[model samples]
Target: MTRLYNDPQAFADEMIDGFVAANSRWVRRVSGGVVRATRTEPGTVAVVVGGGSGHYPAFGGLVGRGLAHGAAMGNLFASPSAQQVHTVAATAHRGAGVLFSYGNYAGDVLHFDQAQERLRAEGIECRTVRVTDDISSAPADRADQRRGIAGDLTVFKVAGAAADAGYDLDGVVRVAERANERTRSFGVAFSGCTLPGADAPLFTVPEGRMGVGMGIHGEPGIHEADVPSADGLAELLVSSLLGEVPQSVDTVRGARVGVILNGLGSVKYEELFVVYRRVAQLLAEAELEVVDPEVGELVTSFDMAGVSLTLFWLDDELERLWGAPCDTPAYRKGALEPAELIDDTELAAETAAEIPPATAASRQVADVAVAALATMSRTIDEHVDELGRMDAIAGDGDHGIGMQRGVHAAVDAARAAHAAQAGAGTVLALAGDAWADRAGGTSGALWGAILRAVATEVGDERVPDAAALARGMRAATDAVLRFGAVVGDKTMVDALVPFADELETAVGDGAGITAAWARAADAAAAAAAASADLMPRMGRARPHAEKSLGTPDPGAHSFALLMRAVLTTTTNGRNAS
Candidate 1:
């Protein structure tokens, strides 16, 4: 359990500040994450890697001379926002291009892809390689769906080495893909982790029991069994991984591989060595040659009692790349010559702000938006515990915390916009950016898109009426669907679609905005409850879809809750007027 934190909401940001202060030689603080303090060749390809913050050495620690040029660290167990990714990439990109790499999670994919599109639009060459190496998450035929675990180190190392060796963007991408294809990993957990200020673990294992195929984000395992001895556990991981060597390698026998015996937070190094002893013996008995072996924490969940093993199959070229020198804050290999550092003044420039023009009438409506946002924040705060409990059933238990952070930020932004005499559309747009930028997850991205769609439909040209409100709701639904989910996918879109349809119908039948919203809110509540019967087809919950069968999706439930809360606020305001 995390015993120390000043404020739960400010944990990630504060942690980054302390890390930059401690590792001044290796990295400097950037807005989203950190970039290498040392300078690189001007036209070299830049390799940027990152994910959620709890995975320490993985992201920020790996930023230095022969590893990632920068990392866009996100909130705990969440992916960085697209805006965050774009900002870090822009700061890191020197001249040639940029290569973005990270775990194959839903939020990371969405944000990184969006950032890649944005960079290309501005004439900066950008590419991505998502590490899919956890064999237990998906079947052999669906390798693309496997989650990236500790094997992330292998892919990131190779990609960074390729970039450091002066490979172009295409060449670096090719090597990164090959590394991901060859790497395989499996893990187990004895117990789950607790976030700061949380009273309980995200999920728990029974006494003397262990979870097999557990994820790093405190997600429960696919199966549970009695705990095995160190040797027995070693055999479990080794045999399972050897059974699925990549098709490129004919067999594990006589093949050379790089191995990482990674500790997932609470597990001590001495216990890891005990397990590794058996692991090394077994690999030798199987006639496999192990190259440079690493045994320690590389990627980690906050205080998780678990460990993972990764095998990276290597050919001659891959061997050379794997052996390349790197000097990061946490992980270091062979020595390298000293490099020049980036100037402080040039790196301190922040992202440029945008203020769209607005009309006088729309500014009055902005005040109303501010009130709605404040009410939404209070509602989310009230239900945070319930939302976290629901998410822990089949996903990472951070939904409640993420939503609270996002809504609080949105409320603050809306209040500031109202004070500035901004229009309704501008206020909504600014609030959307704040929510996505601070929340940094799948929910954050989807909600940000919904807000932006509504903002576009409610421009400052005129006063927004029921017809305009219906149109904005419709646009929000469409934007969510096109972003990555549909009604049956068991996401917020399930509730949102029903709410939008009912609202449009009510307004068409001559109902006022408040009445239409109330009716739509009821529809959303029903849709959210009905989602319990569904099996998730997308996002992190997909791998454990069966486990989520009897529970409502946290995303859908929160959306419905927000709808009902907004309806009450709007209806009360109308009655008073």
Candidate 2:
């Protein structure tokens, strides 16, 4: 069963019970799990929000201090009943009035509309503000119908601040609407989520793919695409948001802005920062001044592997309210220095030094290696499913995917260069470029560094024998460990260290190049298999400690597999001769 709950009805009750238990001083359930927070001052404009239960700190948990005055909790992935909405509104209503704000979803509209009518009959002045910031969800002419995601926080923050500042109901509603207008959000989900008591996820996404425009409650996305690097994904998300809003501060006429990088449940802070680095770069390029930036799980779907980006365009009034003190369990504004540009001169010098001068003989060897790696790319791809499933037992299941993607990209680069010029060294240089360009994450960078180090060693050489190959392997190994810091960490080093050691021993024993390669490959494969019993000592799996036991390190396994493929191909060629 995908969900952990015992039954469907018990889901709502359990959630409300926990919420009130934890926040008894500020919030309580009136009826049907409709949560209300006592206003600090009576007759102040009441800001009410409600939505499905899974989006916590959204409509409910946001109901304190400088946020919502009342939160009408709904069932899992379902809108609250009209009765529940009305009950919460009545409890929060003072002599002044009430303002209802929520995402632009069909169920929300239906229930909130019913509650508005009922509250008006009881002499409570009520108004509604809809959050419609997802540009991917609707056409330009119908942007008002877009779904709200992380942008809800900006709406509630500005609206609640208005109410706290003693704005009347109409004024509060106006400021809330203005905040909604200035905000835009978009999200990409790598996987779906399961609701309480459900046997299946609310939606499904194919592995190694990302669904752009996926909804908060595991709704299907607008389209699915191959998962790109964090930088590429950040560009896609930020560009889409900028397309909807103004691209520059000049276009916004020097308006202050707030950027929120929100993780949907399961994405960790490390991955979020990878995405945020690109986001800050993009915003600076656009010349927009970020008044406040937030990064974390402000809103989430249960265990969804995804992230959402929200941008709030700010004027003087919104900026003042944004800076207003807020002390909540989830939202906070801390002191931050202005963003600064990073110096790239050192990086430029390093890149120039890394690129080797092209030569004919070196090109041929590089081409052959790239082709060999490409031929084994499918093997890596096939292993990804098994590796991921195994990793889920102990580590995150990304090893197979990462290696396959990095190798395929390297192979494609080599083939393209070989096609352009049949010469040998051109292919190797091209493969190195491809590996550097397409590979991502720590493994990708390490793999790219290894290839580049090999290229530098073989620069302009027509033929590399056992000694030259041994030298290149040693250099590559040193570069990988230097950059990755995975030596003796039970990672790829398990396979790589043995392979390098065997190659050096074979060379000292005067073994032929082919014999040395065969022995090294076998030793590497054996070392990789033996690592299954060793504990993971590095990367994300380190925290789990013993959990990674019995699961072979993905990096080690890939290295072993690649060694086997290269050796098998070389030995077969010798036998045929």
Candidate 3:
């Protein structure tokens, strides 16, 4: 369990600041994550690797020479927002293009893909290679759907090494993809991890039992079984990974592979050495040559009692790249000569954006928006635990915390904007940015989109009527749909689409905005409940779709709850009366 935290909502940000402070020689705090403190040669491919926090040494810790040029760290167990990724990539990019790498998770895909598109549009040339090395997440035929676990180190290391070796963007991408294809990982947990201030861990294992095929985000394993001895566990992980040799590797015999025996969190180094002893013996008996084996907490879930083994099947080129000299905060390989430190001015200071002027009518509307946000924040606070419980059934249990952080940030931004006499549209837009920036997950991105659409419809100059609001709702629906989730995908879009449709229908028939919204909220609530019957077809829950059955989709449920909460604001101005 997490024991130390000043504010659970502020944990990630604080951790980043502290990490940079301690490792200023290797990394400096950037807007989103960290960048290499040392200067890089111009036209060198900038390798930007990252994912959710709690996996140290993996992200920010890996930022330095012969490693990641930058890392886009997200909130705990959540992928970074598109804006976050863009900022890190832009900050890291020199004359050469940027190479973005991370775990193959839904939120990471959505945000990184968006950021990639944005950079390409700006002619910054960005490419991405998602690590899919977890054997438990998908079958061999669908390996592309697997999650990235501790094997992320191998991919990141090789990519960074290749980039430092002066590979162009295309070459760097090819080598990184090859590294990912050649890597395989399997993990197990004796217990789950707890977030700061959370009453309990995300999931738990039975006493004397171990969860097999566990994820790094405190996601429970695919199955549970009695705990095995060190030798037995080693046999299980080794045999499981050995069964799926990359097609490029003709056979396991005589194949040179780099091994990582990673502790998830609470597992001590001595205990890992005990397991690795058996692991090393097993690999040797199988006639596989181990190269530069690493054993420790390379990637972790906060205090999770878990371990994962990764085998990177290396060819000649990969071996060369893997042996390259590099230095970073957490993980240091062969030492290399240090370069000049980056000037402070080279880094941009994060400043609040100035709000555009608005009329008194628009400012009045902004005040109403602020009140609605306050109500939404309260609703999230009340239901946060329930939402997290539902999400924990099949997904990483961070929904409640993520929502809490996002809404709190949104509330703060909206209040500031309202005080500055910003228009309703500008207020909502700033709030949306804050939400996505702070929360940083699929839900955060979608909510930002929803708010941005509505803000556009209700511009700073005009007081939008019901028809305009309905149009904004329709636009929000389309914005979500563009993310590729359909009506039955068991995402927030499921409830959002129905709510928008119902509101549009009610407004078309001459109903007031309040009445229309009430009807829509009713539709959303019903849709959210009906979602209990669905097996998640998207997002993290998809891998354990069966487990999610009979539980309402967390995103949909939260969306419904917010919808009804907003109605309270409409019923009574400021929802305080």
TM-score of each: 0.98, 0.57, 0.98
How well is each residue in 1-577 modelled by candidate 1, as lDDT tens digits? 8999999888999999999999999998888999999988898898999888898888999998878999999988889999889888998998989999999998888888888999999999999899999888889999999899999988889988888898998999998999999999999999988888788988899999999999999766779988999999999999999889899987668999999999999999999999999999999999999999999999999899998999999998898989899999998999999888778787857754566667877877777778888889999999999999999898988899999988999999888877777888988988998898888889888888888888898876567898898999999889878777888999998899999999999999999888888899999999999999999999889988998998999999999999888877777663212
lDDT of 2 by residue, 1-577 (tens): 2445665545666878877778765566665443333435767888888776777767677876667877877655555656567767777776689889888765566567767988898888899998887776666676676777899889988998899789998889888988888888999999877654434454567989998887776555667899999999899998888887633234653556899999998899999999999999988888778877988887788778899999999888988887776644456554323322222221112122133454566556655665566656767766756654554444434455445555777787767666554344445555654554333344555566567676666555566678777787788889766644465576788888889889989988998778888888889988888888988666545534476677677778788888777776666553211
What lDDT score belongs to each candidate, Candidate 1 first?
A: 0.89, 0.71, 0.90
lDDT for 341 in candidate 3 is 97
Worst 10 residues of 1 by lDDT: 568-577
**Residue 550 lDDT, candidate 3, scale 0-100:** 94
Sorted by lDDT (best first), the order is: 3, 1, 2
Error of 2 at 272 (Å): 0.8
For candidate 3, the 10 contiguous residues with the lowest summed lDDT are 568-577
lDDT of 3 at 85: 93
* Best by the lDDT measure: 3
Residue pairs of candidate 1 with colliding backbone atoms: none
Provide backbone clash counts, one per model.
0, 5, 0
List runs of model 1 lying over 4 Å from the truth: 574-577
- Model 2 stretches astray by more than 4 angstroms: 1-3, 34-39, 246-254, 333-577
Please write out the lDDT profile of model 3 over residues 492-547, one tens digit for every residue. 98899999999999999999888889999999999999999998888888888998
lDDT, candidate 1, residue 30?
83
Name the lDDT value of residue 269 in candidate 2: 96
The list of candidate 3 runs beyond 4 A from truth reads 349-351, 574-577
